[model samples]
Target: MDTLITLIRWSIATYCLYFLLNNYISYFYGISLNDYYQWFMLPSKQAEIEKLPLIFSMILFLLSVVFLNLLLSSIQLKAFGNFETYIYLGNSSLYDAHYIKDGDSKVIVSQTATITYNSSFKNIGLTQNFVSNSSVTDGLGKPQSAISMGNLFASLVITFFFFIPMLGPVHALLSPMLAETYTAKGLNVFKYQWNDSFNALLALKGFSLAKWALSWVAILVLMIYCTFRFPLQQFGKRAMNLPSYIAANQLIEAVPVSIKPIYIERARKPGETQYFKRIETSRRNVTFRFDKDFAQSVYVTAIVDTENNNLIEDKITSHINSHGKMQLKITDDLGIQLVKY
Candidate 1:
């Protein structure tokens, strides 16, 4: 039973770790593991998936560190146990001190004699002051015992599944908007006092610096692994079996024309562009009518037939003299054509 419970715990932790890693890679690297693998399989898209600029990548790395710090700090705060409770015993003047004779020492006898104290004084004022001072000291001094095992486990589960995996990226993206909102509501986010206040709160919550450092190391290691592992794997595969990869792409392109999917698009507006999907057909002329307006000029962006295959222009420009009626003549043999007026 214990082994089964331990296995279940490890399984949940592993799953949460994978979930967080996947989200981190997807957000920072612009692709997930599965998507990266699929793209690697397709040789055509290899050049299209460009690496991010160095400066932008550095900025993302810093942002991820900030987000991870915030997440771990919040979890630590929530998992920390409450401070020792202090009961008010009225004023110091209410209780009278009576000295009780021991063999060699004298002890104060009072209604609260059972209560522990640093000294022989029975004054509630001194006790209150001591408790207040010790509370602050203990808050930062002892963090390991400040958190219970059960609460830490629960907090970890919530942090991994919900906070880090789901809301981490969203918060990072919307942080600027949130700051503006706070500023509009009279809370200036750029102020240094807010930083001090946050530090004080962390101290009060018994945040462990050691644990935070360890978390940073772990996150950095994981980031490095996720960033390079797939790219290196792809490079190795291409270098090793280049012919097989090329053959796979060629095989995909050699699919039968009759079974190939056909896509047809029609213009909703007078000067809208139209795309004619590639197909194998006999040479024939096809006519189309623009019911809305007449086109003065027809700009063919691309035309691909059995003989002539060329992209006329890089971009399509709508014709200005589109008025009463328009007619279009397109050869049916043009396998792929893009027309605009």
Candidate 2:
């Protein structure tokens, strides 16, 4: 089967990359690959890898992903759909182009017809260093969600240095959370007045049992959060009682739709720090976060029809309230804010 063959070749290619990078990536940071592997990748190295300068450290992180994509091409593996397919299987085909001709457009479609599109992406850049005024809170009133280069790479960097000791398989299951924290709260260092990266690494050696336990709890919680995920959609149940607006077709209809914090991330160029941009698909997950002390505002986007998209302009507004004790204000077009208690 083509699927099985793809997987086989993909695995071989990825293992090759791992074999190469696992031995050399740390070299870019002027650190020992073995120490990083044993201390951080194996036992969450108490921030030892952080010893490298921050920018250089992030550079190494960035290069590892860049190289992974580059190596994928060497194996003749091209990703066709979502990253979940080729990423684990080793791939270079995620970026693609196609010429689609409408069956009925032959009147104007000939060999001379050509179309071009120019765009950039930063969806892959390291975000643990992106300082922002945004925030998200978990059920326990703990805010834990925000934008990032991606959870996958974020965890990859984390597992290489900070995850609790575990087998390769276990690390695979828990790496996403490791990266997310640094990505979302990378600024926590500035916001909370924590020590620098080097001290954090040194201090981690004495992390209390409670801290270790909390780390695992955080990982499990993030896993469960996305477990029942759904796409960020317009017609389904969202925005607290949104389904009430659905028509007989069980879909929400709007003349114009715009979602604030178009959070998938921007596309980027090499050497410019990039993050993964999500290709259009029916699958998506929406996360509601508190930008500040409360849910100050929520963004809504709907596509009633073609030829209409108004996000930057303020044509609509909304609000959210619960338990009668507090109400969250929301501007229809912008994200919530981040403020101290």
The backbone clash count of each candidate, in order, is 2, 28
Instruction: List CA RMSD, all candidates.
Output: 36.6, 22.8
Model 1 stretches astray by more than 4 angstroms: 1-32, 37-47, 53-58, 81-341
Q: Give lDDT per model, in order.
A: 0.31, 0.28
Model 2 per-residue lDDT tens digits across residues 206-226: 544356456666765554443
Model 1, 1-341: lDDT tens per residue?
53564465455544555566667546433446475455446777445433343234334444444444433443434455233322122111222222221122322333322222111111211121111112243212222322334433433333333333223333333233334544676655435443343333234346433543456566556555544442210100111111222211121111011111123444355564544434444221211111112111111111223223222111111111232222222233322222323
Model 2 segments more than 4 A misplaced: 22-35, 41-341
Q: Which of the numbered candidates is closest to the native, going by highest TM-score?
A: 2
On lDDT, the leading prediction is 1
